[model samples]
Target: MADLPDNASQRRARAFLPALEDREFLRRDELRGLRFAMEYHKADLLLREWGVRSTIVVFGSARIPAPEAVEEMLAAASPGAARAKAERRARLAVWYERARAFARLASVRGGALTQRPDRIRDNVIATGGGPGIMEAANRGAADVGAPSIGFNIGLPHEQEPNPWSTPSLTFSFHYFAMRKMHLAMRANALVVFPGGFGTLDELFEILTLQQTGKAPTMPVVLFGRDYWQRVVRFEALVEEGMIDEGDLSLFDLVDTPEEGWESIRRRGLHAHTPLAEAPDATPRAVDAES
Candidate 1:
């Protein structure tokens, strides 16, 4: 093993002795302690390296359960071993459908959700580092050879840093609040995709921020027109008079990548660099209490 740094606690048994710097033989336990501290501090450094600007946070379902085995067998195979064959076919079809759904979600008119300089230049893509839609967006950016970032979390399920991410940019967080912080910090725009509870959580957080003027200049774009319209009834809020008609204008519903790009660009709202560190990179999650 390489020799520990002179300041390493193990090497500097005097680390705890009032003096902060030391240059001596490192103790095993002290070395471990120093290493842990270094590892913990690396989170921010990694995030900074990832270039956290111009991000579009995309979320979507991972489990699009395949069709029933019997249905597949009936569609393809006949009697005897037909059931097994049919089931396999059905599963394959569902997988194909799931892949297609992700492909459409990843496709932004310009190209696949691979990394690209345009995302960095346009301030357009970022996400909660994982598979599904997040992977698609990062992949799309990578497709064009641009560094993409992912705020990956240590989750029991539904989380992993996608392969497309710029190596140093992948961040794993112990705190959900911290992970969410990185998501909204330098975000020039928020591009929401169809997802379950996590998607709803992120959507509301952004809405709350814009509605409260906390992230006033930031604009939100919702992808998947049909899904969004059916999922939430913003019109009801407007009609109820709880919010003004103008309030609904904070976010624009978009069906295509071109339209989504145009809306933000037309207004000049997403001009800021998405990765530049913000003065207020730390904000309480956007909710009534926050």
Candidate 2:
């Protein structure tokens, strides 16, 4: 055969070269470790670029309905046991509303929307990017036109990002460890509404972090005194000597958004002097030594 054209030869040579731009190469099994590291770096860079100084992380059940939707949901359910379950869920609707209000309060007071170029964005509401209290908190931040974050994880059921999260700040992660790391890393405070397995897991993770001095102690507000008291019986843990009595001070039980905010303020926000010209917006590392 006649010699291949020079251009064709060059094209073949280029094709054989391992191009970093090749998606197939990036997806190869050998690149899995690199891919994992990239996931962490990508999120870290984006968060820093967005000036996310710190976040108020919110966790709760995805099943909770908006306050207005509770009545409709309860009415739609069949009578008897089904109706009773709905009624119980409906009673918890207040927590959804409270989460919303708490987020708004934090966003407004935490300098989320401040225009000062010197200010670091602080106390931006962060959530799991699913419905229920997550949507409520994101919606609350959106109510005041503040930026918020959603760290969504891919699952079998495929949780969708809530509509209210700032589109640029919403992130999806394939690794639960990475997702939880991002959630806990910059949290200035944690407000947990009544929830199931996921919420309990997250709550305990932060508590363990604080208990073991793995992370800086931040205000952990367990919203809904009655619900938490009945569900966890934390005092029992103390009495049973499963946890030290001092561990009880790691969290506060608050019934209302105002109380939650106050607890956070007193525990986490009190030391810093309030800024008159614009709050001290510098981004301090959550784990920075005191």
Candidate 3:
């Protein structure tokens, strides 16, 4: 190699490496489309490989803590206003357990624990992969020893994915659109808890899809009736002709986790797993392919 001449001919003869191997080129601004494609395919391919054909998409507040964490905040507060705020959060904190319980119920009944003869899993819990409600949902799936997904996103502030989701199915995305797509792609039903701007964004995305007939009419449940009613005057949209009166039926309001799951069941979320079938039945009915 030392004997090689340092000349124009030698430089040209080197034969530059393929662009596919060029990490720097891939990171360039012009390759943004490729980056987006990569984000989508990574999650999509992995979800398929894991046999996840459908999911129960859960969306909720990241600020809200588990019940015990809120209790700790209550204990640490110095006085009046701080203590009052902590107490309020303590009330909302119950949602953490509710989300967890709901996820467990879905996973146990929704074929996530049992791969059918065709090897497809449905109603596998999928969350934003952050803490609070996301963590609670993922944790619930873990509780029942079922697989779950955590579609994490890159945020300006350092956000971490919860540990409860299956490692093979956990993913991180640089694009919110790609992350949202993954969340909505295979969603069999949606369960939303009390949350702020980000949660609202996701909720409306699916609502718009269903409203425009872009997505299937899946059951949607909005947990915490009081919070949702106080926060969103959905009736105003109907009265003002911004939306149809029936558009409000896109989601059901419920106060408890049991009520939330019941609404979905009533709305036609079929439990394809053996657990839901008749005990004395002979041959099981084949689960409909997704």
Any idea what lDDT model 1 has? 0.58
TM-score of each: 0.61, 0.86, 0.88
Model 2 per-residue lDDT tens digits across residues 83-103: 999998898788788888887
Q: Which candidate comes out best when scored by lDDT?
A: 3
Cα lDDT tens digits for candidate 3, 49-114:
888899999999987788778767888987999888878777887899899888887887777877
CA RMSD, predictions in order: 12.2, 6.2, 5.7
| Per-residue lDDT of 64 in model 2 | 93
lDDT of 1 by residue, 207-288 (tens): 8888888874676777767878998999999999988898888888876665666665664553342333222222122221
Clashes of each: 27, 1, 0
The order by descending TM-score is: 3, 2, 1
Global lDDT of each model?
0.58, 0.84, 0.85
True lDDT of residue 55, candidate 2: 89
- Compute the lDDT of residue 26 as modeled in candidate 3: 82
Ranking by lDDT: 3, 2, 1
| Runs of candidate 2 exceeding 4 Å displacement | 1-25, 270-290
